[model samples]
Target: MDDDSDVSGLRATLRANPAGHWLSTPAPQVAEQLAQTDADFVVVDTEHAPTDLESVEAAVRAVDAANATGEDGAADTAAVVRVAWNDHVRIKRVLDTGAAGVMAPQVNTVDEAEAFVAAARYPPEGHRGVAGTRASRYGRDLDDYYERANDRVATIAQVETAEAVDNAGEISAVDGLDALLVGPADLSAALGVFGEYEHEQFVAAVEAVLDASTVPVGTLATSLDEVDYWAALGFDYQIVGVDAGYLRTGAAAALERYEQVGEE
Candidate 1:
């Protein structure tokens, strides 16, 4: 929140900001280390990890530290959480942990997307219950929190299935939905042409989402070539793999070179 990088307004930044994500291992050090990278944001993935409430809290704190300490306490980066699903309990928990946004996964239809917003948003506008959480600063400023949260916390719908692709337009029509986030891997799997998103059909699906989204679309691209590709295609937000990739790549290359030298 201190960053002026309104999680809710990330779509606006995508016009100029090149946001990215790194998968952290539910460890504060991991998140902190990843935060030190050049990415605009760090997405805390709780979907595949055994991240409990406490770990999520610590990860946020670490990211905040990484973001805050960098430039005279100016907010350099943001901490977001990808809740396991679009469930209320998980959504509330992540928000309580001070996540600037929630990435709801496996969205297959418009109704599911609507439900996600409803569960994440606070009353009248949404069914989300008011709570004394860290995100709201423990009810210390409930009114201020409510007034800002409705506009501050972002909602990202992960388009992961074939059905989601078919209903992209309807899903994108939902108000308060920040970005139409696509999970290309799951999409490939569901298409029955696993890992073949480069195929014509998959590419068409991507185009359909792009054509339909009222807001800017977000995705995870694999390489610099891919980043250039997406940028040309008008994708506003993207994650260019992880910090681990760079580290592991260099480490493996170094190990191989060392082995060759020793053998020589």
Candidate 2:
């Protein structure tokens, strides 16, 4: 990555298109394929996926390769890794993989949000230990990377609990936080209305976060309909699809079609 080529573009893209959509996948090949599309970013999910640091690094490289091979010679797609937790070790390791950003899950307070951002930043801003990692081109671009990493790295906090909803404003106000994402499945489950997005309590919690957030707010949308639904409800951005879900749906449809043809 070049000096000016950090996640700044990703941040700018989201700012320009509040309803910008992203895709999440655990596979590097899948991430590369998705990154080649118009999606603003592709998330390599470590939170719920069986992905490790090595996989995250490979996925980030794949996304970068996709951008390098774009038809126009400039692909806007960036790689954002969803770290398994708010721990600094995980956040630092993922960022070192050259991911454009890191999304920390279950951040429910200002302190947690700050910690999340700090882990992605270098000294003076945070305590992220510097190294000649892939992010710095193995010591070749260390100086430039260190100088720009703090500003270039985008930090996102996932609001999944009632406490997060109540503290959304404070969390959003954290200096280095780029965005807030509502983990709908977890948030709903926390509110005793699992999968019931239409439930009053669930709606209220989402609305609370939406209303309190000072930065761009987003959520995960599993289907096309939910895209419009969340957009209408004022979500700033969304992860529109999941790789596993797509595979299952596509395979099922293909089998159903084949069964119908055999019956005919």
Candidate 3:
């Protein structure tokens, strides 16, 4: 959530790898330029942004446009939305926009995780009420949408609390979950040790998450050194840095390292 570091296309590209250019950017042509750089998927972060219904809809349109240029048979850089929270209504509305998945935030228990999955799916597989909207190709095909929801749509729960770490196994074991995303700042706060993911206790908690998780587990790692280490430890995916983080860090480094003829 650092500044504008949305997770929309990024999440999808990570899951739908090796299928053309899955990378996409947020609103405006900037996103398309970014998508051109290429990736496996993209994600739009609505949870932290002031993204209202209108804006979310616009973002999806932009991402889809970028995906169109990737190549024939391009995976289309599945759109994903990280809703503001685990609210079912919000989940349904965003999914209605045609996002390929949802990333539920602050899930601290198995029940919360289950509730998230249920909200993301429809009957038999879940409790999400059926609604023929833009997500199902604008209602052109109802049965196909129902049949494929469980398969094509993904749900990733964010494990950012100490209690969530404690119940990682149970939460991850939920049938429809595709992955567990660790939110560092929240997790650090929950553990009573802010900004120190490498601390022994924090590390232990993370290891527990990975060990107990039945699906892919990931977190943000800023530096190349840290990225290599975590990946070596079994994290297959990570955000090098969120968009806002990259901007601020750049500004700070430029000012700090700039050589003003007389200043050392």
Best by lDDT: 2
Q: What TM-score, to 2 decimals, does candidate 2 have?
A: 0.90
Candidate 2 colliding pairs, count: 1
**Given candidate 2, what's the lDDT at residue 6?**
42
Q: Candidate 2: which stretches are off by over 4 Å?
A: 1-7, 18-25, 68-75, 260-264
Tell me how far candidate 1 lies from the true structure as C-alpha RMSD in angstroms.
Answer: 3.7
Clashing pairs in 2: 18-236
Q: Root-mean-square deviation of each candidate, in angstroms?
A: 3.7, 3.6, 6.4
* Residue 65 error, candidate 2, Å: 0.7
Write down the lDDT of every candidate, Cα atoms only.
0.76, 0.81, 0.70
Candidate 1 local lDDT, 156-207, one digit each (tens)? 8998887898888888788777777888788878877777857887788888
TM-score of 3: 0.81
Give the least accurate 10-residue stretch of model 2, judged by summed lDDT. Answer: 1-10
Query: TM per model?
Result: 0.87, 0.90, 0.81
